[model samples]
Target chain A: MLKANNKVLVTISAIVLFFLIAPLIMVIITAFGTDATIAFPIHGFTLHWFANVFAQPDFVAGFKMSLIIALAASLLALVIGVPLVYALTRYNVHHQAWFQTLFLSPTFIPEIVIGFALYQGLVITVQLPLLLTLLIGHFLLCLPYVVRLVTASMVLMDEHIEEAAWVYGSSRLKAFLTVTIPNIRASLVAAFMLCFINSFNNIPISLFLNGPDLSMLPTAILNYLQNNYDPTVSAISVLLMLFTAAMMLLVEKGLGLKALNEM
Target chain B: MKNRSAFLLLLPGVLAICLFLFFPLLQTIWPTLGGSGYSHFLHSGYNRNVLGRTLLIAVITTALALGLGLPLALWIARQKASVKSLLSVVILFPILTNAVVRNFTWIIILGKDGVLNKVLLGLHLTQHPVTLLYTNAAIVIGSVYLFLPIMVTSLIGSVDELNIEVEEAAAVLGAKPWTTLTKVIIPQLTTGILTGSILVFAGAMTAYTTPQLLGGNRHLVMSTLIYQQAMTLGDWNQASVVAVVLIIMTVIVMGLMRLVTRWLDRRPANA
Candidate 1:
């Protein structure tokens, strides 16, 4: 009976994995197809589609914009998030739970709602620039993960060491810089990369905030795919997936997989 | 001294949250109530339809995601380490891919002369290509495809943490496989299921692109309604009203989720 159950489980696993992986494989296959239209079972193979992806001006501009926005947003999130994480985890603030919830609520709300709300509030009421709006949206979106990871790391660290540093001669700022920052460096790096990936891949907010000239890569690809159907989008997607995977591997190597799992 | 530094450290995040996050949330509520009147915005027939459709799609997408994602997550949970890692990567591909790219891929796949219909016609599977795009079904399919990974990942987190010995012990004590699974494993997985379901529902509720692309002009989810009002109609008040309604609904659902999870957490230890 156990053997039969194990076999059934293995078969189920294989089927699920196959279904999940097949689309990506199909995407890669379609990318290399010599035919203009994307179709299964390629007649010939070529790298012209990938070449096209590079040649497209919109794609190039969008890629650069997405990189800049993602970097800026993640950096801003880290700057705000790291200190917030420190305060929440170390200090006994009044209404700490409320503060935590307030900070983390962005993750709980729907991205679409947040996007729309921010658009209405910023574009309509505040007249914020599109770039600034995008920055604000991405920063809010990525803040929760950074705070959660950093706070978790802080909670795991021994607080006595910080207290000892304070008792010895270091000022609170000096102690935090010398002790807490170094202790949670792994979590901070992980938070930065995670926030970067999320900000980079984010679509809902970008869709709302993307202007004519300031289109992010995802929005550009979206618009392109809407008007045109070809393997160029697939090629771009393949590149994105590989890039993210490479980053994940790098993060794993630097921080350890255990830290990521905790995140 | 410690308190001062802590406050200083927290000031940036707090200020950002207030100015960008909470302030906008509060501002979203006013137009819904303040524009004309609460009843005027609330009773707007067009807004009602948008809200209804948004809720329906959210609920439907959540159900579908749970249906497809649960089985896959369970299957994944039982996989060997090497196989699980590979499968994890595959499952996360849709997530890592730009949402615009994925949704557009669906547009191509489900379009009038797209791959699926073309294949069906080529194989003589049907007399003519069935119209698959620009429909609720297509929206549901695309949204499920988009959000399934979130559900699967959350469920996997819950399932992986569960102790398997209870199921094994139940099996050894003359319980059938189905009986053990239904009675033992699933109850323990409820928290994970709830978390995944809530996340999926939230994603579906706020989904703009999938429905916009796939549902076309026929269907209007809340996000699209807001877009239409603000951008197309140039009615910021109406748009803000819709946006406010979306925010309120999301908050209510999330609050309910928390209540349910808290109840579950407080349940008798053995159960």
Candidate 2:
């Protein structure tokens, strides 16, 4: 009876997984289905729609912009977040917990709020450039994630290693650069991957920040969907999924998906 | 390191949040303070209804996510090491993809001649293609899909840590399986449940792509309404007010979640 109950549990969970991934699988299939429009019973499979995705200028530009913004934001996140985590962990900061809470608070707060605030605040109040606003919004989004990843790595490292370097006449800065950073290189790389993918796939932030001249890939796809019902968007989505999936596979391999699971 | 140097090291991140996050957030609501936007939210039945609907959808999505995700978590927790890793990867896969792609996939699922309708019709459950797309139901489906992964990921480690010996103890003590689950297992999972629910509920309430793609003009959630207000009508004041209302509600929910988690943590001692 116990064995039977366990079997039932597994089967039900598998069904739940099936339901969860069903849409993703459908996107892949629909991308290869008949072009122009989607119907229930897809006719002969073809890659015509996939080809049509690249033919659109908006999508191409959006893809490039997403790439640039994600890379820029991730790089910025690392530059800022590495030292932030280092300070919080290594130095005696008053109310370190409060600082940690404040940084990670972004992930808790709704992105819609963030987007709206940036739209009015950056565009209207600060008069920043459009691209800069988008990058800044993404940097905020990526910063907490970077801090969390690096902090996890920091918690596991032996303090003796850094202390040894310090005893050998290494300055705190030199010891950190030589002893600390190299030890947590994997976590840093994982953090960069996570931040890059997150910024790349973001919508709410991009929705408010995206101007007429500057649209990210996800926002552009949405625009296409608004104008057209063709499976072209589906095709582009499949490609995006493939790209993200490849990156996720890399993260899982290197970081063991622990970086993702924590958040 | 000097405390001052440590503060300096933290300054860049603090500056980024202040410059980009807090300052922007304050500015978005600042204009609405002297305007009719506040009254509009208070008196506007239409706006309140939209807000209520957003809350309702979020609640249902949270409930469904818990219902579905718990089982998945339970099973994953019980899996062997190898199966556990593969299943973990598969479970986390949807969240890694772009929001538009996931929402677009939902559009296909809920479309008129789409996957669900096709199955329903072929199965003879419905004589005609039920209008599933562009409805609140579609929004619920999409939100649930969007948030379910987060719930499962949150629950996995907590459930895995649960002492099965206690469950077996209950079962051996003449407790039914349902009783064991309800009495023994669930009480311990309060932390995970609270964390996941807050994340999902907050997420569903503020979701953009899923609702925009699935809930068209006919159905207006708070997020889409804010978009329409700001982008379509260029009414930044009203949008700001709506943004403030949404933020207030989010803060309340987060506060309530913290309270509930604390209550849960403290409850067992009294028992």
Candidate 3:
């Protein structure tokens, strides 16, 4: 009976894992298919679609813009989030839980809501530029991850190490810079990568904030998919999956995948 | 001195969040303050259907994710260290992949002449290709696929926490597998189940891209309705109303999640 139960468990696990990976494998397979339209048993194989993806002006422009926005947004999130994490984790501030909740509240809300909220508040009411609003949207989207990952790292670090630096006549800022910063470097890198990828891959926020002049990579891909049904998107999807997989490797090396479950 | 430094340290990030996050949320809810948008939304039958459909889909996605996630989590929790990390990566792939890229694959696989139909035709399961894309079922499938990783990751912790000896003892007592599962395994997993359900439900409720790409315009969820009203028809009033409704749904789910976390803290003596 136990053996039979184990077999059932293994079977279910196999099926679920296959379900998770099947779409990704399909995209990868279709990327190399020579046929214009995706079909069963795929026709001849070729790499022309990859070339087509790079040749498209929108994809190129959107990729550059996505890089800029993601870098700026993740950096800003790190700058703003680091101080918040330090204070909350190190100090016994009043209403600390409430403050943490407020800081992390953005993650709980839907990105669609955040996107529309920023649209109404910044673009419509405050009259911010589309690019500025897009940055703010992405920054808000990345902030919680920065705060969460960095906080987890800081919490696990020995607080005494920073105090020891301070006790040795180093000033608070000096100790934080020389001691605390070095301790959390791996997690900071991990957090930045996580934030960068999230901002770059974001769709709803970019969808709402992007104007005709400014297009994000994900939304641009979305637009292309809407108008065209060729394997070029399949090629692009394969490329993105590869990029994200590389980022995941970086994150794993930096902060171990177990840390991601800190939430 | 400590208090002052803490406050100083927190000021910049707090101010940024207040200005960017809270302020915009206030703006979103601002237009609906007159209550006209609420009345307008409530009066429309189509709006009601969208709301109902959104809830229905969320519930279905949550149930499906839990059904699948429990076994996967259990299996992974029991695996050797080397195999566990590999399985973790496999599960994390969907979560880390770009949303557009992930949904694009579903679009192909579910299309009329797509892979699923191809296999079904090959196996003679159906006479002809059936319309699988752009339906409520597609939305549910896409969402479950999208969010199942989260459910599995969350549940693995609780599965790890379960004492193996108890299960061994139950089996030693000649209890049937089903009996051991119901009597021993499930009660301990209640918190995990609740948390996973809340996360998956919230995800499915607010998912814009999956439902947008898979369900198409014919089927409208609240998130898509907000996009359509605000962007397509230029109806900010109606869009704000739907956005506010989504925020409320999120808040309620998040509040439940908070309660679950608090419960986890307060109760440490789980056998």
Candidate 4:
């Protein structure tokens, strides 16, 4: 009876796991379909849709914009987050929990709320330019990831090493630069991956914050999807999956999948 | 001096978050405080329907995710290390991919002449290609799919910490497996269940792409309603009211979950 129960559990799990991946697998398979509109049991295979995805100006531009925004947002987040996390972990700051909560608050707030809030505050009220507003939105989204991952790594490392470096006549900056940073390198990479992916794949923020001239990749794909129901979207999705897979490999090499699980 | 130094370190990031994030959040909530927006929202049957549907979908999504996620967590927890990592990679794929890309695939699978209808017709299960996409059920499926990773990841940690001996002890003490699951194993999983439910609930409630793509314009959830009000209708006041409603819903759910988890935690001690 116990063994039978185990079998049942395994079967249920397999089905659930399949459900998680089935959409992605379908997207990959349909990318090569010769049909004008996407359908199953594809009549013939072709690389035609792959080339067709590039023919669209909006997608190419959106891809470029998304790359720039993700890169800038992740890099800026790291610069601000590393120092903030280091201090929070290392210092005797008052209301440290409040500060930590403030920094990490973005993760808890729904993205639509954050996006709409920023749109109202920045775009409407402050009158910031669209690109700057977009940058700010993406940066807010990225900050929580950096704080969580880096803090986890920093908390685990021995503070004594940095203190020891200080005792050996090293400046605070020098000790932090050499001793503290090298220890948390894995997490930095992991944090960057998380930040980059979140910013890149984000929809709500892009949806609210973007102007007519500005478009993120996901939003552009959404625009395309609204008008067209073709295999070109499947092609774009397959490329995105491949891009994510490459990033996953890089993270695995740099940090490992364990760091991702912790997130 | 230490505090001063810490403040200096925090200054840049804090200023950015406060000026941009928190300030905007306040702005989003500020209008609703004036009473007009809430009165307008409360008066509108359409607005109330969207709010009701969002909450209902969120609840159903959380429950379904827990049902599906608990078993997957247990299965993954019992796997070998290498196999565990492999499964983790597979699970992580959806979490990492673009939401639009992910939802788009569902559009393909659930479309009129899509994979699902085709299969159903081929098997003589249906006489016609049923409209599956842009329905309430499709939104639920997509929401559960979008947030299941969060649910599974949260539960896996709790499941790993669960002692197998406890369940065995219950079984040996004249309890059936079902009783052990409900009484022993489930109690142990309270933390995971609470955390997972809250995350999944918040995610499903605020989700835009899944509902926008799968539910389409006809089936509007709060998130999509906010989009329509703000972007399409260009009414920031109405949008902010909806946004505030969403924030309140999430906060209440989270607070209630914490209380329930606490009650569950203390139940055995009381007994």
TM, every model: 0.92, 0.95, 0.96, 0.95
Error in Å for residue B140 of model 4: 0.2
Docking class of 1: medium
Candidate 2, after superposition: displacement of residue B179 in Å? 1.7
Model 1 sits at an interface RMSD, in angstroms, of 2.6
- Candidate 1, superposed: residue stretches over 4 Å from native: A1-12, A261-263, B36-47
**Number of the top-ranking candidate, with DockQ as the measure:** 3
Q: Please tell me the TM-score of chain A for candidate 1.
A: 0.95
* TM of chain B, each: 0.92, 0.94, 0.94, 0.91
Candidate 2, residue B186: lDDT: 89
Q: Write the per-residue lDDT of candidate 4 for residues B154-267, one digit (tens) a residue.
A: 998998897787777777788875677678877778789888898898889888899999998989999999999987999888888888888888778767876887777788
Worst 10 residues of 2 chain B by lDDT: B262-271
The candidates' DockQ values read 0.53, 0.68, 0.70, 0.66
Docking quality class, candidate 4: medium
Q: DockQ order of candidates, best first?
A: 3, 2, 4, 1
lDDT of all predictions, in order shown? 0.80, 0.86, 0.88, 0.88
Residue-pair clashes, model 1 = 0
